[model samples]
Target chain A: MNLALVTSRDTDQAVRVASPLAVRGMTVSYGQTPAIFSVDMTVRAGAMTAVVGPNGAGKSTLLKAALGVIAPLAGSVTVFGQPMAAMRDRIAYVPQRTSVDWDFPVRVIDVVMMGMYRKLGLLGRVRGQHKALAQDCLDRVGMADFAHRQIGQLSGGQQQRVFLARALAQEADIYVLDEPFAGVDAATEKAIIAVLQGLRDAGKTVLAVHHDLATVPDYFDDVVLLNTQVVAAGPVAEAFTEANLQAAYGGRLTTARVDPESVAG
Target chain B: MGAEFVALSLPPILIGVLVAVACALPGNFLLLRGQALIGDAISHVVLPGIVVAFLLTGLVATGPMLLGAAGAAVIAVVAIEAVRRLGKIEAGAAMGVIFTAMFAGGVLLLEQSDTSSVHLDVEHALYGNLESLIWLDATGWGSLLDPVALAGLPVELPRMALALLVIAVFVGLFWRPLALSTFDEGFARGLGIRTAPLGLALVIMSAIAAVAAFDAVGSIIVIAMFICPPAAARMMTNRLGHQVAWSVVFAVLAAVSGYVLAGYGPLWIGAQASVSAAGMIATVSGIILGLAAVAGPHRTRNG
Candidate 1:
């Protein structure tokens, strides 16, 4: 680890408790309506954590607040015990594919290159080396051949892969994803899980807002069940029980069941 | 045609090309962001800005006009934001109301003032006084190099050219940030790109383009050039780089061809007098846009 790049305070905090993400008494509201309130969660460093919740469960909101995308009505979040701003270069964010205008006239390579925009902004030109790095990222996600295709021409799984490739291009210490597995095929889901597991092996943290519950224990080492608050958060086997799932999903047992009516994980 | 006739026609034609290119360059970003009417809104809104500046300074200098125009651009955006919030109106309606009200107020102010003595008037605000700009005091190209002749150049042409250069530099320098911000604002923000300053720069660039084109192309053509060339270019290509290139090509084509046709089309029909060049340029850009909208590769007819 490059101690020179990180603040001393952050290093001390990481040594005390190695956690990439920490949300203490966090609250977020939208126009007088509280979306997520009084939530506290700390994701273990170098682990894959799945944030599982029903729709509007503030699962995505939690990630947004952690990244400073949405202002928290209360509480604070830190990355490796430092403010997100100070450690921004170490965080890679992958927003939901639906949030992007897929119909925008751009090639897949252009979207991947956006991850490198921060490094090349206005001053450095996009050289062949940058393109090679972007291509390598794309190849990792198994979409290298589709680099020249227009964004609007991709399937749901392909679009998701492109976004992951973008985050890969960031070369960050941690990745935060929103709804990555939504509507993707089983093969894409496996591929994504493999890539995330590889990152975990490399001592990098990945926090994803996941909807599929059946594979939580199989795909993740940690779990945070949330519904306007942290219903439960710990090791996946410990926190992902049926009772905690019920608490997060309210009385709706049908959708709360593990992966409800899908192929077995 | 005689060399004398060619020299007489040179300045206006060049002016049209410069103004069209200047307006169209920034227009590509506006088109991509789905803010095509912002140019029109700026052109109309800046009328009051120019009028108030002229009213206060009692002179038609670029300095006061530019200051007033920039101020109005800021006010116009602020007013639009207020209307959208207060009236609970959508952005389109809010923009429409503010620009039209300010334009009407400008016309009223012009009518009430002693602008009759000045070259500026309400009628000229719509169609422009481009036909009257003649820079051929000397005979040929050699005399054009003379310092007196150089200094005596029409201010409108030079102003439009400088605006073009500024637009080129701005887009070139900020291409990455601007493209990222426009395409995905949230993603840009997450990348720690401060999008607000870039957005403000975009609005300021539009204001500058509007102010520069106002004296030469008028409010109507300023708007037409802004929306039409970019929209046509968008239809012609799916890549942003190609869109910008095709937009410049379309703009130059429209400018030169429109000027030539406006000044010479009637002579082909046995009529003696020419039509308004500004109107022709606007019309030609519209026709190009209409053609692209109907026939361009980007059209969506079927799967």
Candidate 2:
């Protein structure tokens, strides 16, 4: 399947039509409680997009629904113009650290290798090639030295890096990461953002569920402001306004100067 | 005198060894999943099931009794899962309620039935009887090749062969899913692995293992057989594949040694050997578990 070129609603209409990821009218619920409501958004290829919202704003739920980890209560999610299941190998997901057991008895290399499990298939052993790819992913994340260490032994930021390494190993066209910066050290956070920026520069779409409002304008070129539903989404300069922030965070967004260093140069 | 001892002691030892192999295989998976106490619960709750099957059939048929036991165990598992899902109770508490109630019902059933007169006793269920396993019949290639050797050896290979077959089938069929699910449920699910069939298969396998041991060592000692070897092996290894391999080796060793002890140890002590082959095998497994606890890495202080 080919990646669909979606119309950019904010930039000049004549700029060019190219969007790699799109979720149309996606709704998700936990039992009777609706977590997300009819959310429509599109992500451009070769662009880093940040999904920013307050807690309980359905940010994590949206990412999970896109990954097909949780079936949407209503609507559909498409990656590169194909359904989620048909494009399982093309999309990589990095769940939040809190979603997994830190004490699981597996090494960092083992965690990274899981990204290759789907490609390997059942009864398909991990050959030398797979191991080499996994190591390369680790090296890219600057975690090659810690590859053999148990995941539980790593700090929170290190754990997040290991997860990113796993996603890198998948070699997918798109990435959906949930809370990639929560509780990580400053260096680890910068390293993660650098890897993400690298992915964006290499013609890949990166969708991150970000919590720190302070870094939105700097880290992401595009922003989707959400509170149960899509309040706004477009170029960072256009969508990230004080009025939209107030709508999403409900007076929690204090007006402050955006950090210059946080943005991609 | 020595010939008689060999004839009487060898079969029980062989049976104990088989029981150890059976329990050790599934015990590793169960322990890794942190559902170790389910073994205890299944053993206790299956008592009523066996008693009821016996009452209906009027004969201690291994097939029907095992089926009944397995059915009861499945019910217990489903009940545990349901309670955990619906009432939000801990798995251990749910298991406790189910097993105690079922075991009490079994005792009541046994006391009220005429099967009690036939020595279908509960004490025998707890301790087991190695002396009762006499040579029933020797058939197969021995009869075809050499009638004399078959008559001379008097080996009961059928039962042991059957037990080994069960172990092989389960390990072969569910090895991958079992390993994955034991380690991480979310990761397994993310990979699109269907866990329900594997979980059901494990419960059934545990029941089959328990039933296989019930004939040789009785129900209560089956717990030791199922739990001890794997626990001991865990102390020695952390890798899932290595743990299973070592557990099998430990189980076979326990069986043979327990049999030998039951047969020969009594001669030296000059006292009635209170410990049956099954009990000895379990005790050996327990000792192995203790050593593993002491020497193995990842030793939990709480344990």
Candidate 3:
């Protein structure tokens, strides 16, 4: 291999060591009950990491707290070795599809343009280049034709694609998605995984709260098995084991099993 | 028109239109956010605000009244949030409880106070004296060009105009952020949009509109203008920009048509006296909303 290739490979290893997202002793509570308590996780750079757990396992809560979408009761989150506030521009977040009002009066393009709000700043007009960029992002998710349509007119899968297109428009270094595959069609899942893989291939980090355990081995390179606390976290082959899943999901996961080939990797 | 028209009809029509447009502007976002009753709540509480202001100052000054009403609006919002959080009540229930209690307290204060000389009665608070605010110095349409005649305009007219301008500027300056946050608060927050403060700012602007409109148009017209025009406009368009434009048109249409009908509809029926202009304005807006609900192109959600 060339010297440039070898140097880049060494840098990739270094980047993997230094994580894109690191949660240190995070504890969150809703009212009197704690949602996530004293949980810690480190997301590897240039790889897609799946956060899989049972329902009510605080998967969404942990992601929200880590991204500062909701304030944590205690502890801190660092993005790319810096505080979230300082490194906000480097992160792109896609919330749950149901988190927004579907009937809101905005076109698909308008929703996608919102991703560029930080760069546009207050009072900045949407020029032609911005529109072109947004359209290009939509094209990536097979949603370019729906750009002129009202957001509510789309099907659930199309809506998910539009949301992913919006995140793509953000052009951030780290992509964080919350249940991106939930409620979406199989086609949308395939399209989304392809986009995420493209992001990883481009040396960007991705962290997703995944619900389908069956797809974890095929989709994610790293895994964080969580149940209000970190049960196991590392490379998928090492951490996403049947024992770790059993410990994390307890008796809730009855049918999920680790693929032997995936573990052998 | 003649001097009679200039002296009798101009100021109230202008003020009425201004109040309607002001309230309807913020009403669009409020209706979309499912907080339509916030307008209703703010209008009701303004009675207490003005009453306390009049009680304190012993003079029916515009400054004290506006200040008092804004204060009451803030208190009502805070109280509603407190009740929803601490008392574990839903927002609608909390709003209903606080606004009605404050309104009842205001009526009690009005009855107990010895200010029978001023125009601060409960009926005036509800219906407003839109017909009574006439311009005496205007001689004709020539008054439009005469600075001296224009200077003698009703204070409420200029105040309402200024309030409408402020509200319009606010909505304009924050249109993108407001649309993003109102549509998806979590996504907006992730983008570092400071959605909480933006929501509070929106409420404050709504309160300002409520207080300004309440001073001239009464709580009836304030509540009607806040919900009816925007809700009607919503049925007419799927685009927010179009909805806002349609709302302004509907507000103006309601104000002008309602004023004319209230003034002339009685004469057409051979009645000597005019009806309450504020009530007529509200009725006209409700009628517009009813029509839009029935026949507007985008009335249904699927459209």
Candidate 4:
């Protein structure tokens, strides 16, 4: 039985690739307070998965630990069946809009070009082809005209779109975004969702720390309900039930009512 | 200006210009990262580094000074981080406590050591003896180009230039990574660009620039040059490339004009001796920053 189990594990590694992101027993802390505890999850390939949780729910911390931005207290994350460090360029991150000072001296084009840094590496010359790609990404986000404009010139929604455009320029196989929908306009919300869906349809993994439960059923194929830990994780139909939402939201989300039939259909 | 006057003042002006350029490039990044205080902190902290190096080597030269400066820079960063992490103090408070302590330690070391026998002086460390640093044996312009004559030139000038060149190469080679990491550290880390090393590069560069130019410009003037030109450039331009270019231009202008005014302005007012050129250079940089803050393109456009 032991030999059979070992053979099965070997087959799992050799015959099939690991999911884009697999988190096991992950824990993170801020100072003395624990933010996330033993959170286990897997971001399946070629799907849009929303990580839903309340405020201070360790949503951002989970992503930060996974990317090795903040050192995790415990556990590990594997990307594309390898360590994150081994497969880094294949994943891109979009930090929250508020994390950066918009008034920093950089144009829209400059911000987008930053996403190309992974490909350019250190000291690589930014060629005409790179500029063309940045322009194309800007156009995709309806920010082509504002390429020359400074980041401060763009409004909040426009800023979020600009960020999305930069992520597009990265062309990573997996995208991780933090609070992309916060304080965004309706049109920007639609644009962001469309871009995410486009990424999903192109066989890319997109995991976002999303809050708007109203649009969860419409937007995501899978969901990871989190509340300092993984409450439930799987397809939208089986996992994103009212029970999981309640558990993740800790009964604070009084109005959450997901119809299982529609999710299944 | 008279030929004698021009020849006498040229070295100090060149020295000031090089110092400003070196400080401004690193300053731009520091300002962007909101770590402007780090430049201020580094200048003060480098003094003790210089003293400790002097004590260790019993000789003062480019090599020992650079070593001391780099050591002090590392100590300051580590101390600040340690205090912030272990003691749970905020970064600013930690910086304030450590830099002042380091500066005091250097002063104490200088007082305790047999530094009197050396050419290095406390007064020179505070306000550089710009007039005394001239290449005393030079004949004329021809002397400058002559390789043998160039060798006789004061050790400070070449050291400053080499330091500026080092700063240029450091900034030029790592411009993209530095910008990305500074602007969005989390995103940069996600892209697999280790932000820690990039941050370490900035600290080391600041220390090098501070130590290299400190002998000529003094630590206070180093502080001024590190902040003023970049702050002015930032006010003027909304683009990072333009900000860096404009900072260089502003540095050169402040250096040249400040020296000219310091030496010749006394004559304009019918006085005899000129004021300290290093002081004037720093003052001019400040004036330029103030003007930019009020009338810069960013302000008017935003308005």
Measured by TM-score, the strongest candidate is 3
Better of 1 and 3 by lDDT: 3
**What ranges in model 2 sit over 4 Å off?**
A1-32, A37-43, A252-265, B1-6, B136-169, B172-174, B262-270, B300-303
Q: Clash pairs of candidate 1?
A: none
User: DockQ rank, highest first?
Assistant: 4, 3, 1, 2
| TM-score of candidate 1 against the unseen true structure | 0.91
Candidate with best DockQ: 4
Tens-digit lDDT string for candidate 2 (A89-128):
7777788878776655557888888788678765687899
What CAPRI class is candidate 2? acceptable
| lDDT per model vs. reference | 0.84, 0.75, 0.89, 0.84
**What 10-residue stretch in candidate 3 chain B is worst by lDDT?**
B294-303
lDDT of 4 by residue, B1-303 (tens): 444543576777788888889999999998888777777788788888888889898888868887887788889988977887888876678888999999888888988889988877666776776666776556676666778867767788988899889989999989988998888888888888778878878877887888788777787678887889998998888988899999999999998998888878888999999988888888899999999989888754431
Q: In angstroms, how far off is A68's CA in candidate 1?
A: 2.7
lDDT (tens digit, per residue) of candidate 4 on A1-265:
9999999878655432658988878999887888999998888899999998888889999999988888999988888678788888788888899998888888999999999987887778889999999999999888889999889888899999999999999989999999999889999999889888988999999999988777788999898888898898999889877777777888787554444444443
Off by over 4 Å in 3: A1-17, A255-265, B87-89
Quality of model 4 by C-alpha lDDT: 0.84
Query: TM-scores, in order shown?
Result: 0.91, 0.83, 0.94, 0.93
What DockQ class does candidate 1 belong to? acceptable
Candidate 3 residue-wise lDDT, A1-265, digit = tens: 6999999867744553487888878999887888899988878889999998988889999989988889898988777667788888889999999988887877899899999999998899889999999999999999988888988889999999999999999999999999999999999999999999999999999999998887898999999988988899998889988788878989766655445455433
The full ranking of all candidates by TM-score, starting with the best, is 3, 4, 1, 2
